[model samples]
Target: MPEPELRTDRLLLRRWRESDLEPWAAMNADPEVREHLGEPLTREQSDAVAALMRAEFEERGFGWWALEVRATGEFIGRAGLDEVDAGMPFAGVDVGWRLTRSAWGHGYATEAALSCLAFGFEVLGLPEIIATTTVGNVRSQAVMRRIGMTRDPADDFEDPSVPEGPLRRCVLYRIRRDAPPAARRAAGS
Candidate 1:
C-alpha cells in the first residue's frame, strides 16, 4: 500500500524521500536528540532506517510519516501510528514523534500526534492506542497526556532492550477508543 499523506494546520506528514537523507542524518546524529534513544545512529545506520521505513509503508499500509512544514516544506520531524511490537506492554496502535530541536517548544508534536491518534481510532477503527517512553522522557509523556492517554503505572516495565540500567525502566500510557468524548475533545481532535 502507498503511504497516505497526513496534514495538520502547519505540517505535512508524508513518506520519506531520497531528498530527506541529509537532514535526517543530521537530526539522528545530534546527541541531545538521541538522549532518550541511546547512541546516535551512524550515517549508514540512518540510511538503513530510511530504507526500512519505506519498506514498512509499502507493506503495512502505514508507518512513520515524514513530517514537513506545509508553508516551508521543511522536514520538521515525524509523527504517526504503527502497530505495537510484541514486546511492548500494550498491543495496539502506537503513536510517536521526533522533531528537530528547532521545532521544540512549538506544539507540533501534539498537533501531529492528535491527528494520528484520531486517524487510528476513527479512521482505522482501532480499539485503543498506546505510547511508551523512558521514565525520564517527560517531554514525550507530556505529549501523550496532551493526547488523552492515561498513564498505566501498573504496566510499567523494564525494557529488555535497554539492559540493566537507569533508562531501562519505562512507563506505558494508553487511551481506549471508547474513552469519553469530552476527554477526546480535550486531547484536541
Candidate 2:
C-alpha cells in the first residue's frame, strides 16, 4: 500500500518521488543540516537513505514522508513515523523530522509532526509514540517538547548507532494515546 498524502495549511507530507533525489542529496550534504544527524552524506549515501525510505513506505504504507511547501511545491524535508530499530532498548514507532536550514524557524516541523502523531495514535491505534534526539540537539528536543512529548530522565540511553561522542547520549520522549487532551491541544491538533 502507498502512503497517503497528509496536508496542513502550509505543507504537504507525501511519498518520496524520483524528482526528490537532487534536493534530497543537497540537503543531506549540508553540514548545518547534518549537525546532529552525523556526518554530511555523499550523494551515494543520500540516495541509499532515500531508497530505504521508499522501501519503508512500500512495506508499511507509512514512513518518513517527504515534506514540501504546499504553495510553492518546494521540497523541504522528511517527517513521520518510523519503526525503532530492534537494537534499541525500546521498541515502537517514533516520530521524527529533518528539514533544510532554510525551512527552519517556521512551525512546519511541529505541524507535520502533529499530523504523524495523529496517524499513529488515531489511525494506527498505537498505544504510544516516542522520539529521541542527541542530548546536545536542543533544537530538536524543543520540537519534541512543543509536540507534547514528555521526557523521562530514566529513559535516556546511549544510541548504539551513533559513535562514541557527544552525539551518542540521547534523550527519549513519549506521548501515550491516553495522554491528556491538553497534550493534543498543545501540539495544535
Candidate 3:
C-alpha cells in the first residue's frame, strides 16, 4: 500500500504529486512567503526542491507533505517534520509549514503543523522536535506557541545559512517526548 495520508479536520497531508508542481512553484514565487526564506525561487529551483522532498520520502520514510484542503481538494501549502539541515543548531526533528497568503488566517498552518508534530512525536517515536524562525517572524512564532512548544531563549542563535545581518538572528522552540499531555496534544490540533 502507498504510505498513509494524515488527515486533520479540514486538510490532508500526503505525498507530493506531479500535479502539485504549479501551485508549489507559485507559493515559492510569492514575495511575502519568500520574505523569511530568502528571495523568490525560480521554477527550476522550486521543482528541484520538490524532487528533493520526493527523495526524502523514499529515503527517510517521512518528509514535508503536500497539503490539500479537504473541502475543496485545493493545494494550499506544506507542513511536516524532518531533520534539521546539518548546519542548523538542532540535530533532530523539526516541524514547519508554509502557505500562500490566500490561505493565511484560516488556521491551516497551525492545523498542518500540529498534525506533523503528532507524526514526529507519536508515530516516528522521536524524543523531541525543534523549530526555528527569524526572530521577527511573529506569525510563525505564534503558531509554534499555539501548538504548545516552549521557547528556549538560550537556544536562539544566528542562522548559519543567513548572511551576517538582521535576518541571521533566529529564535528556537522545542517540545520534548516527556512534555505534558496538553503540550503534546494533537487531537484538536
Candidate 4:
C-alpha cells in the first residue's frame, strides 16, 4: 500500500517529494537542529536519508513523512512512525519528528506527533508506541510528555549503536493506546 498522509490543524504529514530534497538537506545540515541527533549531515547524506525513508515507507507502509505547513506549503521537516533501529535494547513501533531550526518552538513537532500517534493506535491498532532520544534532548522529551508518554528511569539505556559518549545515553518514553483522552488533550486539540 502507498504510505498514508496524516494531517494536523496546521501541518500535513505527507510523502517526501523531489522538491523537499533541498530544504530537507538544509535542515539536516543545520547544527542546532542536529545538535542532539548527531553530526549535521552533508547534502549527499541528507539525500541518502530521504531515499531510505521513501524505501522504508514503501516497504512497510509507514515511515517518516515529509512534514509540510498547510498554510504556506513549506517543507518543514519530517515526522511519523518507524521501527526501532537494529541493535537497540528493545523493539517496537516508535514515533519521531525533526524540524528545521526555523520551525523550532512552534509546537509543530507535538502537533505532527499526535497525529502519528493517532494513526499508530487508532488506525494501525498498535498497543504501544514509543519515542526515544538522547537523554540531553529535553526539548524532544518535553514533546513526549506533552503527548502523554511516560518515562521510567529504568527504561533508559546506553545505545550500543552510538558508541561510548554522551550521545550514547538514551531515554525511552511510551504511551499506550488506552491512555486517557484527557492526557492526550495537550496536543492542543
Question: Estimated TM-score per prediction?
Answer: 0.95, 0.97, 0.95, 0.96
**Model 2, span 14-95: residue lDDT tens:** 9899999999999999999998889999999999999999998889988889999999999999999999998999999999
Candidate with top TM-score is 2
lDDT assessment of candidate 4: 0.91
Q: Indicate the residue-level lDDT of 3 in model 3.
A: 52
Each model's Cα RMSD: 1.2, 0.9, 1.6, 1.4
Candidate lDDT values, in order: 0.85, 0.92, 0.87, 0.91
- Angstrom error at residue 53, model 1: 1.2
For residues 71-153, what per-residue lDDT tens digits would candidate 3 score against the true structure? 99999888887788897766888889999889999999989988888787678888888888999899999999988899978
- Top candidate (lDDT): 2
Backbone clashes, candidate 3: 0
Question: Which residue segments of model 1 deviate by more than 4 Å?
Answer: none
Instruction: Sort the predicted structures by lDDT, highest score first.
Output: 2, 4, 3, 1
Per-candidate clashes, comma-separated: 0, 0, 0, 0
Error of 1 at 170 (Å): 0.7
Show the colliding residue pairs in model 2: none
